[model samples]
Target chain A: GQQVMQIPQYQHVQEGEDFTTYCNSSTTLSNIQWYKQRPGGHPVFLIQLVKSGEVKKQKRLTFQFGEAKKNSSLHITATQTTDVGTYFCAGPVGAGSYQLTFGKGTKLSVIP
Target chain B: SAVISQKPSRDICQRGTSLTIQCQVDSQVTMMFWYRQQPGQSLTLIATANQGSEATYESGFVIDKFPISRPNLTFSTLTVSNMSPEDSSIYLCSVELAGRYEQYFGPGTRLTVT
Candidate 1:
């Protein structure tokens, strides 16, 4: 079975500050996907990293995958109030598998 | 990304009752999954529904308690049987379109057993 762990279960930062959440897996992954869930909404797809050591950016959010493909990270530069939500990292159960195992997720609270 | 929708956005039911949640995808998809999210907790994989076959349940979940059905590529249902207080949570269904690794989730059905 594959397992994904995330650090800093909860984070509260002032608006304009930076935030980062790290995710580690017990086994190497073929690809990793990131999702965001608002206070009372369903999880929304954010981004997906496939290549090892790949780095992708969307506006103020940056996603990186480890060279070994066993870990990933999401960094938000200058967080805004709208950034309040839980960020989750998920990976396929195995190579070419469709089922995904998601990390516990990091809940971010932005204070203005 | 696909447009996913779920029926009965939220509901309150009595203990021992059963509720079925329906998921519909605007476009055809290859893979669909059901997840449960308890209060203040992360999402847990309940099962993976494959078209024209019995769903594959994850550890600790069984077909009796949470039966799933995927009659076609765009529709699925998950029924919570013999609900209890612990059964109260948000149930969400996600789908992976062909040739895509990312999965998109529905709005989710919030169930509360009284």
Candidate 2:
């Protein structure tokens, strides 16, 4: 079975500070997806990285996939209060598999 | 992305009781999955429900405890049987649309067993 691990289980930052969460998978993944879950809401799809060494950005959030496709990272520049939530990184159980194995996730708290 | 709706947003159940959670997708999908999330924990895969075949349970999750039925492509049901205090958690159903790798999750059912 494949496993995904995340670093910095919990993080608290000043309103204008930056934050980053790293994810590593026990096995190489075909693709990796990121999700955000608010305090009382369901997990929402954020972004998906398919190509190795790919980098994508959405507003202040930047996502990067390692060249080996076995790890990934999410960096938020200048976090705000609205950025408080848990970010989870998930990857397919196997090549072409629909089932995803999610990392423990990094809970972020932005202090205003 | 898919729009999923789950029934009984929240419920309180007694020990030994069973509660069935329904998941309805806005469109027909081929792959649907059930997940459990405890307080401040990551999402754990419970099972995979594909239309027309038996559900596949993950390691640590048994079919008898979390029975799932995919009667059609747009709907599925998960029943938590013989519940206990540990059974209390948020159950969510997600769908992976055909040809897409990303999955969309439902709002989830918040269940608390006494």
Candidate 3:
């Protein structure tokens, strides 16, 4: 089993501003996946970063995995109302097991 | 990816009562997991469900408290036994993808114990 932690449990940003959240794991991960859960909504699949030092982007959202595979980050450029939600980073243990260890998550509040 | 349909999306019950939440996946999976998300907080792993074997629960969780059942690959159930208000939270069921670093979750069952 692995433990992942996210910093700045809560964040508030104005519309058009930038926002970022970080996820750190106590143990090395095989891969990392990020998810978003809007208020009163189910968690939605967002993105996954596998390789070390890998960076991927979707529109204004950017995701990065640390070179050591022990940490990851999600950065948003020009935040909007739709970006309001709790973001979580999950670490998959290995190829054999399908269990994914999840981080506490960072709650983002976007104000227009 | 898998589509999950969970029953009893939300419920409010008195203290000492129990609740059973069901998770049904469209496709068969080798493994399934259960999680709990508290109010204004994050998700915590409850257990990993194996089709033919008993589930392996994480620390701070016990089978007597959170009894889980996996009768087959595509379905499972979790019962919160003799619950208290402290057990109020959202319960989610998920299945992981083989060789892929992802897990698809159900809509979640929100519980409110009074």
Best by lDDT: 2
Better by lDDT, candidate 3 or 2: 2
DockQ of 3: 0.71
TM-score of 1: 0.98
Q: Compared with the true structure, what per-residue lDDT tens digits does model 1 show for residues A1-112?
A: 8899998899999999999999999999999999999999989999999999999999999999999999999999999999999999999988998888989999999999
Per-prediction TM-score of chain B?
0.97, 0.98, 0.97
lDDT of 3 by residue, A10-60 (tens): 999999999999999988777888999999987888998878999999999
Worst 10 residues of 2 chain A by lDDT: A92-101
Q: Which pairs of residues clash in candidate 2, taking residues 3 or more apart in a chain or in different chains?
A: none
For model 3, what is the C-alpha lDDT against the true structure?
0.89
A1-112: candidate 2 lDDT, tens digit per residue: 8999999999999999999999999999999999999998999999999999999999999999999999999999999999999999999999998899999999999999
Please provide, for model 1 over B2-98, each residue's C-alpha lDDT reduced to its tens digit, 9 standing for 90 to 100.
9999998999999999999999999988789999999778999999998988899999999999999899999999999999999999999999888
DockQ of each: 0.87, 0.92, 0.71
Off by over 4 Å in 3: A93-97
lDDT of each: 0.95, 0.96, 0.89
Top candidate, metric TM-score: 2
